[model samples]
Target: MAWLADAVVALVALLHVYILVLEMFLWDRPAGLRAFGQSLDAARASKVLAANQGLYNGFLAAGLLWGLWLGPAGFGVKVFFLACVAVAGLYGAATAARKILFVQTVPAAIGLALLFGARA
Candidate 1:
């Protein structure tokens, strides 16, 4: 169970890292355009904003990795970062895209469950 939880956390971290790359490096490219359903002009115009958002995603990934690196001693850190991800996912789902709920929130939720359940 602990391993499963850790795996989920790692997956979430990787996802955030991918998001960071898309937003920061590809915001004005074909890949970013398709990912965000933006036109070339729109992507170009919003490149700066996307980069800022990407930086935040990078921070999230870093936090998750930090937690994972701490091993069993990092339970609190893991929970905290997972909660942050879950909350951010919920907000994104509410304001930007509902798909974020499944992509982000659901995975965090699953990880949370495994973390707590494993302790039992």
Candidate 2:
């Protein structure tokens, strides 16, 4: 179960990294524009902002990976980052897109649940 938690955490981190790449590197590209469903002009207009957002996503991934690297001692770190992800997802869902709830919040929620269950 702990392994499962770790796996989920790792996957979340990877997901964030992928987002980072999409937003930072590809936000103005066809891939990023398509993924975000933004028009090319809009993507170009907000490229800088998207890159900043991507950097933050990279930070989130870094934090999760850091927690994982700490082994059992990283429980607090994992929880904190997962909570951040959940909250962010919720906010995004409310303001940005409903899909965010399923994409970001649910997975973090699942990871947090597995972490708690593993502890139990």
Query: Which RMSD values do the candidates have, in order?
Result: 0.7, 0.4
Best lDDT among the predictions, by candidate number:
2
The residue-by-residue lDDT of candidate 1 on 40-111, one tens digit each, is 999888889999999998998999899899999878888998999999999999999999999999999998
Give me the runs in candidate 1 sitting further than 4 Å from their true place: none
Q: Give TM per candidate.
A: 0.97, 0.99
- Summarize candidate 2's per-residue lDDT along 1-120 as a digit string, tens digits: 999999999999999999999999999888998899999999999999999999999999999999999999999999999999999999999999999999999999999999999999
lDDT of each: 0.93, 0.96
Instruction: State which candidate has the highest TM-score.
Output: 2
Error of 2 at 74 (Å): 0.2
